[model samples]
Target chain A: MDLRVRELIKKIRTDKNITFLLALVAVGVFVAQIVYYVQKGEVFSLKRGFQALFLSVTLFLLFAVLQRITKTGKPFDKTIVTLLRVMAVVVIVGGVLPSCVEVFVVVIRGGIYTIDIANLDIFVPVLGVMIGIFSEIFSYGNDLQEDNDMIA
Target chain B: MAIIVRLDRMMADRKISLNELAERVGMSNVNLSNLKTGKMKGIRFETLDSICDVLDCQPGDILEHQ
Candidate 1:
């Protein structure tokens, strides 16, 4: 058909591939967590394994929705941006909640001095904040794209 | 809010259809429609030139400062 349409399709495919790579990373993190639990001979209980799995799943779902947004060719849609922001908030809160609870429990039980810094708790919060930063960048880009689209 | 495109009136005076003008201007019908309805925030100089050439009118004839 049209040259512009062909270029648009190519761009969408590229975006899909990027999202797929991100999803793959999320899966790798999930699998790595499983391996860590297995190596430690842990029972993989809900408390320990569930948080890792939840974070990875949230990341995967975020990328999936982003891919769909690119496919729909409405990147500047306000509702999509809002959904992305909400998911980022969910990821940030979910990633930090467990660690906050752990710290609270330690303080309550008079074990605050025994807090370990070698745990994975720090990484999750950073990752979640990085996702939040990306979400904000995307939100700004959406506003700019919407303005561009309004130009004749 | 100040700039207005009087394309519809010019097209009426020139007896030219939207489709014919769009083809001559080398732009899509939807884009031309948006421009005509003042929904667009800006217009390119190239498009303005093409439109003026096709309509045999000056830029001021089609654009107005309201």
Candidate 2:
């Protein structure tokens, strides 16, 4: 490969893929537990199967990528930094992607009913959840940094 | 990761122990440990001054640009 191509590949590899993957895994395991319990320990029904497959693939792919990033050691930051980045992405994507997808699927299936999408109160709650998670994760990073400083 | 902690070497050449230097510089043992281990991102001018005074050497002896 050319030098630029190699550099690009290196960057791609260094991206905090572990965080992504772990986040995926967190969401996956959470959903899996719910589904398993809901379905009486059987992952059979179409809805349960769909949930399982979606969560499993998403978690596995994302977590695997993140795990690779953590293993590279080229990023050269504290483990805390790496973990925080991973946690934030995991938390955000964990909460948003599935909900958004589900909402889109439901809306599309239901057709544009009399539900006034314009006057909807949906965005505020979602934004609040995102912000809450973001703040918690941001503080978590700071705490981790302080812990590292103490350790050092 | 290849940080060179010249503090130990300089102290050794001057026949100084870490405790003696830390006491002379009026720094806590913990902070001194951090400096000696190259865990310090920076040293204040006051700290450098104190260290230089105690070591009887210029800042150049303690810090070398890599």
Candidate 3:
């Protein structure tokens, strides 16, 4: 391999390690928030708790995906594609489930539930779908890389 | 796999070691070994040219269709 390419790969590995560490720290912070809420005997909204849990899980998955990419030294790996797809699904679910839970809670409390169109946040699920699309693109790139490797 | 690599036969006929051919062809031993064993999916024109130059043979002498 050329020295430049080796240097670039090393730089990318270092960047990924930093990102992974940051993600781990973010997960720890979220978990600590949940613990603090539990210890305070606060009536933590179930929706809020679930959102925190989902966010933490997503961050941890990001950490794992970054670690895997660093280890393989290939961003277009099949496993990374799969992990990104899973992350996309999780993000969509995380975005939508809180709203569903809010509606359920309102209905159970005997309050007339109204659709707040202005408050509906569509960006999160859209971001998830975009990630899914990117994963598909990465899958195609992985196939091309495999083909290139097979040739002399 | 209708097209087959006959690199092993060519190398044997020329009495060339894999390491020597790889060095002369400017390719790694593992890649040259893969070519010799017919494990490669395809060959680049440049690589084929180099191998031919090293072996003093034509492309047909290193490849065959069955």
Question: Best candidate, lDDT-wise?
Answer: 3
lDDT of 1 by residue, A26-144 (tens): 56666776677567644332235546556666756666665666566665566666666667677777777756655565566566435566865666667767767777777888889
- Candidate 3 versus truth, CA RMSD in Å, comes to 2.7
Quote the lDDT for A67 in model 3.
73
Comparing 1 and 3 on lDDT, the stronger one: 3
How far does residue A87 in candidate 2 sit from its true spot (Å)?
8.4
**Taking the tens digit of each residue's C-alpha lDDT, what string does model 3 give over B1-66?**
899899989989999999999999999999999988889999999999999999999999999999
lDDT of 2 by residue, A1-152 (tens): 34664575566665645545654665666666566646663323323444444445445544554454345432223443444445445444544454454455556666443545686545534543564565466567667655555432
Q: What is the TM-score of chain B alone in each candidate?
A: 0.97, 0.87, 0.95
Candidate 3 or 2, higher lDDT: 3
lDDT of 2 at A8: 56
- lDDT of prediction 1: 0.73
Best model per DockQ = 3
> Which sequence of candidate numbers ranks them by DockQ, best first?
3, 1, 2
In model 3, the Cα lDDT at residue A39 comes to 79
